[model samples]
Target chain A: MAISEPIVLPHATDEVRLARTWAQPRGFWGWFMNVHHTAIGVRFMVTSFIFFLLGGVLAAMIRLQLSRPENHAIGPDLYNQIFTIHGSTMIFLFAVPMMFQGFGVYVVPLICGTRNIAFPRLNAFSYYIYVVGGLLLWVGLFLKTGADAGWFAYTPLSGPQFTPGKRSDFWAQMITFTEVSALGVAICLATTILRQRAPGMTLNRMPIILWEKLVLSFMVIFAMPAVMVVSSMLLMDRTINTQFFNPANGGDVLLYQHLFWFFGHPEVYIIFLPGAAIVSTLVPVFARRHIFGHLAIVTSVVATGFLGFGVWVHHMFATGIPQMSASFFTAATLMIVLPTAVQFYCWIATIWNGRLQMKLPMLWVFGFFFVFLIGGLSGVMLASVPVDWQVHDTFFVVAHFHYVLIGGALFPMFAGLYYWVPKITGRMMNDLLGKVHFWLFFIGFNMTFFTMHFLGLRGMPRRVYTYPPEMHWGGLNMLASVGALFMAAGLIVFIVNFFQSKARGTLAGPNPWAAGSLEWATSSPPPDYNFTELFTVNGREPLWDNAPNQPIVSGVRDDIPEVLITNSLDSEPQHKDEMPGASIWPFLTSITVSIAFIWSIFSPWGIAYGAIPVVITLIGWLWPRGHSPAPRQPALEGRWSK
Target chain B: MAELEHTVRKGEAPALIWWCMFGGPFAWACDLGFSYVLEQHTCSTGHHYVLHVITVVCAIIALTGLAAGMAAYKRVPEEANDHGVRPMDRTHFQILFGMVFSIAFTIVIIAEAVPRWILHPCQ
Candidate 1:
């Protein structure tokens, strides 16, 4: 089929007008109303990092208390709250937000070659709720009333009879806020990936990162409901005198575990898959080759998400369920390794076959390999019923997951940051500082977590603040504390690198890495509308194949907030969809919802009255504002500078 | 805003994709629930045969759901979710997706059911 001739350019005046129309307005109100996905994505990143550092501080305190036998940096009572908030902060605030919600919202539209996300207002709404959720948890901690029921908040002990306080209530509601945020982004991403591909770019042609993201969106959708249900049940039991986990009232304690781990197990993949997607994305770029087994990798990722649901029972192995049921969980848990192994091998194969470039990103990939392998192998041992029985609540399990999460999520996250920092910040990060950060981090991480398996094997359990001198665990505890300090040093190095590079780093033009995806097609940091003109994607590596004169897609109106939607399988141009512009309604709506949730802690009837304001705000957000012409450049464009 | 009137939903994905994505979890949940209920029933009133029958029935039901998912996969277009620009690409990506899940679910459902076959209920 013959391609249509390119649409004629509308000249400099139109471009300036388009830029002004899409530009976020100035002042504090504009900050609240900004719905641009890139800006929102950056907010998610910056806010989540603050939480990560705060969580790290809590961790350092835990390390201090546990440094030696009979150490008294803090008491067991205080220890419980610190550790609970530490886990809660990292998982809810840092991991999901930084990995899936932040990075996905930022990159998904750019990769799909669209101007905005599917639900821009909802995207912004999720961010505000996330911020409030973080504030609520931390504010309670500052007042010396943080949650102490462990991150999972197991029942009966956490019930009103055993422990009565607002701590558990705060924890439960925080889950409400964050998971609602996650679920909102999940719908946005899934719809965007499914319906928003550029013309001529179909499923086969999409980068592997998008595939992992698509799978993650589905996992978030299906897995999050289990957690939402369990958390609500916990809240209800405590506040409303319900009997969801009250054993004396015919409620089963095990019911909570079943539901929590049902979501808990898949949550691993939810966070980890995006990291793997990052690896798949950068490996081929640095290796100077197309990724090997693209379809197989996608299949493996989808398989991981599917099989993730089947294996939740494995986490409950120590409860002494029926032997037959235990065996089934054992099988599913062990079987999950095959797909992951396939992915690892595919990465290695791609590197082995291509011209390897030993860049900073590649250095982290190597780090990911070494660290994740240790985590994965330890996990395999725990998958066994007998072994898990021996080490179920020990530091061994703790060591295994730390390796998994840090190696799986954090390492690749840095790699993505370094690789794309230029594109996002318009400047290359300091290469020497990046290398220093990586080596320091890798050594410190292993030193901290690796010794833990032995401590656990030596009979040191987790969640205990101090130990008897006769236990002989003090030396290793001291070593782990030293390791934590080293990792903190590495983080400080990264922090210095981030800000310094942003302000004074080398300038990076578009496509700094000479990579293939569509994101690299625009200017450094991109324009307000992202693309001056969209390109037709006819192959997987459009940059490599059609660099000089990639076909320009036109007919999209410049004056309004509009994006192209395409057919799912073939990316056939279907229609233009209008995006919601800047609004304070999403922000107002989130406040209304947060009020309902927090008020429900005091009274369940809060939902009844809360419905009114929330409904009104949502209508305000969605009501059609008739299209107005794009704002013209001020008659005196330079007058704003004065 | 008028442009949204022209927006279209993608064609329906093959049924197998839905089954594979959701069927296995549903089957596992059913296996867990029914077996737990059966245990409480039998432990209360000792009818060993009824326990055995319940175990077999749940396994059969789980396995049948998976088999039906496989049967659905057989009829799906070869390119269900693929990015191919041909008629054959109708749902290539979706089909491959369902196919992968179908195999995984079969393994999981079978693995899940294996415990039912081997271990005695209420043990």
Candidate 2:
């Protein structure tokens, strides 16, 4: 751990010179402002955790307010705002952002055999932009003007006439901000997976998480745009009087439903697949076997991404679209169940046939199986036109999503972080505390969401600030609220485990779990440029199969910036390419871009002016230096960018 | 270049190509078509024609892109085609070309069709 300590090298390659090039600074301020994927990823994880707790508190408030059916723990307006922000914060700010972007940004490059994410500067900007967007929403709440139009913020309700002032504007614009951040990261992630794999790391050989990120990035690109278009339109209708969603001036309320659900439906998968990816990565590692069906799992993920787009209309089953359209959406929704089932069976087969580790991460997987199964089954029920009509806007729908999103996504993300944190931080989280966290979250999640199904069957409508006591929904509401407290406690335990593990926990040696993935081939908290000598993998879990005789390289060059180019499909030798060392220009450029985005949100001309600084910075960033004809040749021939 | 020699085998390239083709410009086409159809008309005769025209253009673009991609594959060296193009060349140029033309076509059709869509906007 000391600065003068001898650094260990694991893999050696003769073709290229090996060296350490820390892209980030090591001091206190450097650590604070670090843009390295690992640092930024941890930042995303931590920030998301804080938001998750905040979102959880909002949930508690909602539960308490609803515990006794109009008992007035908070007023209707405040209750609406709390639940709205809670759902938004959890889904947008915490769950998908943290679980997918946070985890993916950190792990994907390492997993894919690269030193850094494709667009490190973009990665850093996304984190900061996300911060600003999150702050914008919370700041609105602190000012008592929190968005009260529900998380979906459906038109007419969220339209200018009904919900006046900057609350909805904050919500709409915040979505723009976050979606932009997500889209930027998506491009970077997608490109990284496509272009940055280690030599011999072919598409066929890619870890499942990379596949998920690749597919999800495309999904985010296409899906986020619809919402971005619609949200911008909504803002226009609110301020500029555009008739996009306003019925009176030829705008249809259904337009909002179409656009929002188009994004929203896939948004579930955007969150869901990453968690599934986590399970896919961890299951194989922990099972001590290659994934039972790698091709099958990756194919299923691709299929799910395609089928995901076709199913958005299912969310509008109650909208009274033509029965044919409804049926089509319903059928698409049911078809998605096929891919999910495929993955489920694959995981079961992997666990059933192989050695099960029974570790904390595995414990969460079991929880995921039980919880997500129920959620998926209930989702199938909603796919039925009749059953959907029965519980369309009720707590049953709410319960179904929570099961899928939290049970499906959040639990798996926690499993992933627990599984990979040691590899990331070189420290092991306390297992005892991890188990406790899992159980509390598992029991509490089921208790909270499961009861809501019954509450919905009893006819409790969702999105209402309060309900009458005579409605007989009080007991279940109270139970749900109590479960919220348990979830909160579990989250608290997780935070403590994270920080405690970092400074004082047991050191996680390289490959502590005896994992086989490429990431495990490197040292825990891997050095910059990832490998001392870039690895050429011949089989899955190459390190394990190759054994201790595996040649490991030592110090080559600590200075002179360079990149190892490899054959695109296989890790074959290519020319050494030099990469630019760290620069603050990307940081400054992103700040200017954010300013332009913020300004444009208020006034259109802000965008035009914002473009000026952006153009200058980008040109400066891309302008070639006169030192060398080419610093780094494309390693994989024309396969991947240098 | 030594780096570009690696490509995914023949089996894998299509899926990556399909995603880029539809996810980017194909989606963009739909959005453009929607705006064109809905912007100034209320489903009038001319409006229907405009919609049809735009749809045809998008289909042509998508189909052409697929065809061009297939054509591009043949032009790609056997080694490159078998593995997959440099993942960077994976852009849907056919779709990109179609998108550029379709937008131009949409504008022209709108200039012609909207007046008919309204029967008379001045009225």
**Candidate topping TM-score:** 1
Worst 10 residues of 1 chain A by lDDT: A633-642
List the DockQ of the predictions in order: 0.32, 0.04
lDDT of 1 by residue, A1-642 (tens): 112344333432257766876787669999999999888988998999899999999999998999888988798888999999999999999999999998999888888888888899999999999998999899889888799989998887777886698888888889989998999998888888888877657667778888888889989988888888998999999988899898788999999999999999899989899899999999999999988877778778877877788788888998878766677678778888989998999999999999999999889989999999999999999998989999989999999999999989999989988988888899999989999999888888887899899999998999999999999988888889899988998899999999999999999999988898888989989887877777777567667755455456665666777676776666666566777889999899999999888888788888888888899998998787878534332221121121
Q: How far is A277's C-alpha from truth in model 1 (Å)?
A: 0.9
* Residue-level error in angstroms, candidate 1, position A305: 1.3
Clash totals, every prediction: 10, 18
Error of 1 at A476 (Å): 0.6
How well does each candidate superpose onto the true structure, as a TM-score?
0.90, 0.81
Instruction: For residue A290, give model 1's deviation from the true position in Å.
Output: 1.0
For residues A1-642, write the lDDT of model 2, one tens digit per residue: 001112233223433333335556667656545567777787888888788889988888788778786576688788888989999999889987887789888888777766677767677778878888898889999999899898999999999999987788889888987898899889889877766665545555567788899999999999999998888888888767788887777889999998998899889999999889889988877787877876567657876776677677788878776453455456556657877898999998998888888988888888888999999999999998889999989999999999999888888988888888998889999999999998888888888999999999999999787888889888888888888888888988998999899989899987888887778878888876576554544345556554444432232233544444444443343555454545555666766777776676577787889899988877876677635634343332333222
- Shift of residue A161 alpha carbon in model 2, Å: 1.4
Error of 2 at A91 (Å): 1.4
What does the lDDT read for residue A524 in candidate 2? 88
Model 2 stretches astray by more than 4 angstroms: A1-20, A26-33, A546-558, A566-577, A609-630, A634-642, B1-123
